[model samples]
Target: MSDEEYKKVFSKNLLHFLEINGKNQADLCKYIGVSSATVSDWCNGKKMPRMDKIQSICNWLHIEKSDLLESQSADSASYYLNEDARDMAQFLFENPEYKVLFDASRKVKPEDIQFVKEMIDRMSNQNG
Candidate 1:
């Protein structure tokens, strides 16, 4: 990819990660011991973080490095759910009523299994 496209994608991934985790530039700066301007540079695609710093941020967020670097990582992300999601998915598969939902979703693409699991869990909570 061109450098321009790469920068744009990098910033997009950074922004997406922050948004999903309910974090802001200030929070990231404080947590990662970076200046607001540095974070701003990252968010604006003007620069990328150092490898060590990127790893530190990933560790702090309890996420894989790919989560912040890859586009649409959520779509293909597997076994990356938190403990609660893991438990909820398991509970749903074991509950007969919810089992029907999973069986019906057998046609869902493998990449979308995580999305289906979340939706079904939400439905189960509502019905419970």
Candidate 2:
């Protein structure tokens, strides 16, 4: 790919991962030891990170270098119903601790799930 194309793909992937991971440019800037301006440039597709910095970012994000540098395929997984579901799957994959709740929900009835959610919301509201 050309430099511009590469930048576009990388920036898109970076932004998607950051958002799903509940992170921002500032978090990336601190973790990768880059300036806010540099992170902003990368996110805006104005520039690309060097190979070493790319490696650092991949390590920090717990993803592969190809995940950052290459375009992801739409049929990456066949199970998800749509893009949002796939994004949620990716989030669960990255954070396995939360996956247990998702897995448990699969075995629950709709009413039971709603009841549990309401209970949790009530508990949270009380605590807050």
Candidate 3:
């Protein structure tokens, strides 16, 4: 691989995300409608994906382009949040109305927002 492609391939965030989400090369091929050789090339760092396919992959993964571009220093970086955070994310995902309310609260006073954040933090720390 060229140095630039090397950077893209070895970051390993895609592999990390795939594993955490219980997928493999075959699964990824199915999801992205690519061949096994293409997926293998990606997994083995033999090639970098084209920019066109990058968007397709990101859209399929529900991720932004930046997630695929972590540096080599982050080869072992985590892609998924912890279980508690995942639970909270799923809660927000399943409750659009609640998410709307939360989003709307952005207009609330900063001090009021801080107080609510602190309350959640204290409760979470106690339970955690």
Candidate 4:
């Protein structure tokens, strides 16, 4: 997806998830250890969260990062499918057919890894 499309999706999803959880920007700021302004930026799609903050968000929201990215809502079956992808990757560590692929793909470039991690965080928060 284009960066703008991704941003819009992320922002919408985050707002929805927070609303479902009875949260607001102030609450999220406290939970994620960021300023309310920062949360607002994220919610408004004015800015995105950094990679380090993604884990804190996941922890605060009690969700897998991947679930936030691929599905629009935490309640969707597609959310679980995203989780399943991670599980499958872990499972593939022991599966002969995928072991080589897993090993080779493990070496992700730093920038790509950060981008993906951020996307997952953004997606999950959006769905929340």
My TM-score estimates for the predictions, one after another, are 0.57, 0.62, 0.52, 0.53
> Local distance difference test, per candidate?
0.70, 0.73, 0.61, 0.61
On TM-score, the leading prediction is 2
Sort order, lDDT high to low: 2, 1, 3, 4
lDDT of 4 by residue, 26-120 (tens): 98888787888888888887777876676677666556665444446555553222454545445544554443334323223434434554675
Report model 2's TM-score to 2 decimal places.
0.62
Residue range 46-128, candidate 1, lDDT tens digits: 98888899898887666678766666545575443555455545665576566543442222344455566678779879999
User: Residues 1-128, candidate 3, lDDT per residue (tens digit)?
Assistant: 46766645543867865654556889889888899998887877767788887778777666667777654354453333344444444554575533432432212444443455567668768999
Task: Judging by TM-score, tell me the better candidate of 2 and 4.
Answer: 2
- Per-candidate count of clashing residue pairs (backbone under 3 Å): 0, 0, 0, 8
Q: What's model 3's overall lDDT?
A: 0.61
**What shift in Å separates residue 41 of candidate 1 from its native position after superposition?**
0.8
Which pairs of residues clash in candidate 2, taking residues 3 or more apart in a chain or in different chains?
none
RMSD of 4: 15.7
Whichever of 3 and 4 has more TM-score, that candidate is 4
TM-score of 3: 0.52
Worst 10 residues of 3 by lDDT: 98-107
Which tens-of-lDDT digit does each residue in 1-128 have in candidate 2?
Answer: 89999999999999976765567999999998889999999999999999999998877766678878888888563233355545555555676644443543222344544455567668768999
Model 2 residue 56 CA deviation in Å = 1.1
